[model samples]
Target: MPEFPHDDTTTNPFAAEPQDRLDANPRRAIVTGADSGIGRATAVALAAAGVDVALTWHSDETGAQETADEVRTHGARAVVARLDVTDIPACGDVVDGLIDELGGLDVFVNNAGAGLQTPFLDVALDEWNRVLDTDLTGPFVCLQRAARAMVAAGRGGRLIAVTSVHEHQPMVGASAYDAAKHGLGGLMKNLALELGHHGISAVSVAPGEIATPMTGQTDTDPRTEDRPGIPLGRPGDAREVAALIAFLASPEAAYISGASVVIDGGMLQMGPQAGAAVDTHDWRTL
Candidate 1:
């Protein structure tokens, strides 16, 4: 696991922008993988901005409930659901059910993802399938269902996916993950073109080295985390990433679609060569 703070929810002092920053809308959303990390923070931020949020968790019901509880503190209705994004047949049902529960859906954040850290030559077929299924195929199904819902409702909507820096750059020992991310980026582009006529906008937010449970860090203060490789010299707070998502979900971003906005503390600016030349850390085992 990556090193993260235990009380991470409080780490980022810049978590919530003024509620007025959000353009008014249905104020309803569904966030997948809301049990932790970027998903949880996005949910909380949306709720704070008066968006009723329905959150889904794969295994961590406790974490899901905790997130929901925080959402409610903002006076927004929060629902908890069980979801496995890779479960294709269930995607439509789950998405529709959440929309029904929320009265309607205005935003869908595809944040649930799986990754592989094996060398390209060593990656087994099963591992490859799992990464593609969860990272690429899952978002495809979810986006389709969500876009259809938004279209049928005749109300404009927001579709945001939490991609990674890998979406734009390759990483050592992450062949499967990189391929899946690239596919996801392409999918979002297609969705924007396909859904724009229906008043729906599709976009992807790419982040690098976020402090989350998946990285073996939970609730840790990123400000104190010494990360020499990152231009900011520290890991990004999950809430910081969430703040960006909240902004994109706002009606202010209506004109923005098919964009892959990166929030990596300028990490991508450092190419693979710079990584080898500057950071002594080996990324292969990551």
Candidate 2:
């Protein structure tokens, strides 16, 4: 593997000691779709790291406010906004409003997304367009706005997107989601290439089989017997994915850019053969 270059040149007059990096607080961050699941978890994680958060949710003001309260409880300032990623102009407005409300933005997390669970052959054109718009275009717009501000400020920044494992692998009954996530990863890579010279790093976090409401899985013991293909033999929690995002956004990961990190509990390592050869004895139980 070729090593990437690290830019360690910083001439901040008021910069804190290197060892006390974590003690330094970031002014603000924006996390979209933060009303539930991974988005909520990531918002809280950033707050715990002493970053004020501007969170957005659609059709769930109460949930969004609840997450904002959690951020406050973590000793970080919080602001909640209603946003629909499908509305392109609204994305820019939201970023502007959040920056105005929070003073400035140092990090932006594009976690808003939608999925359609239908066979590819049965999907409609509108369904495809809707997913692509929300998953890919929304992030692109938000990223553009955030990058402009970060570059203008010349303060360096972090841009991250919560994609899905489908970014790299395809799934049946999830054509739109797969295509959108793939596009998202590509978008991040392109942005990373362009933004690197400006001291802004772009990254994508792809998660797999996370235990969230979207999976329709109850809050029960994660299954292992039926999930032998995964090397870890279980599903991942939203917080586990959040932890990775937090790291990606941290100063420690400054040298990492244009990278799509997959957190799948080793599921991606298991090809279809592992699940296909399940014992007949297990089939009887199902």
**TM-score of every model?**
0.88, 0.86
Could you tell me the lDDT of residue 23 within candidate 1?
A: 39
Those runs of model 1 whose alpha carbons end farther than 4 Å from true positions after fitting are: 1-24, 272-286
lDDT of 1: 0.87
TM-score of 2: 0.86
**True-structure Cα RMSD, model 1:** 11.2
Which is the leading candidate under lDDT?
A: 1
Q: Spell out the clash pairs found in candidate 2.
A: none
- Give the per-residue lDDT digits (tens) of candidate 1, residues 1-286: 8985554436655332333212346489999999999999999999988899999999999999999999999999999999987788686689889989998889999999987778898999988988898998878888788888887886778999999999999988899999999999999999888777666788999999998998888888889899777788888999999999998888778779999999999888878647568555565565
Candidate 2, residues 213-260, lDDT tens digits: the string is 678763544553356667888888888988998888887887789999
In candidate 1 the C-alpha lDDT for residue 94 amounts to 90
Which candidate tops TM-score? 1
List ranges where model 2 is wrong by over 4 Å: 1-25, 218-226, 275-286
Q: Relative to the true structure, how large is the alpha-carbon lDDT of every model?
A: 0.87, 0.84
TM-score: model 1 vs. ground truth: 0.88
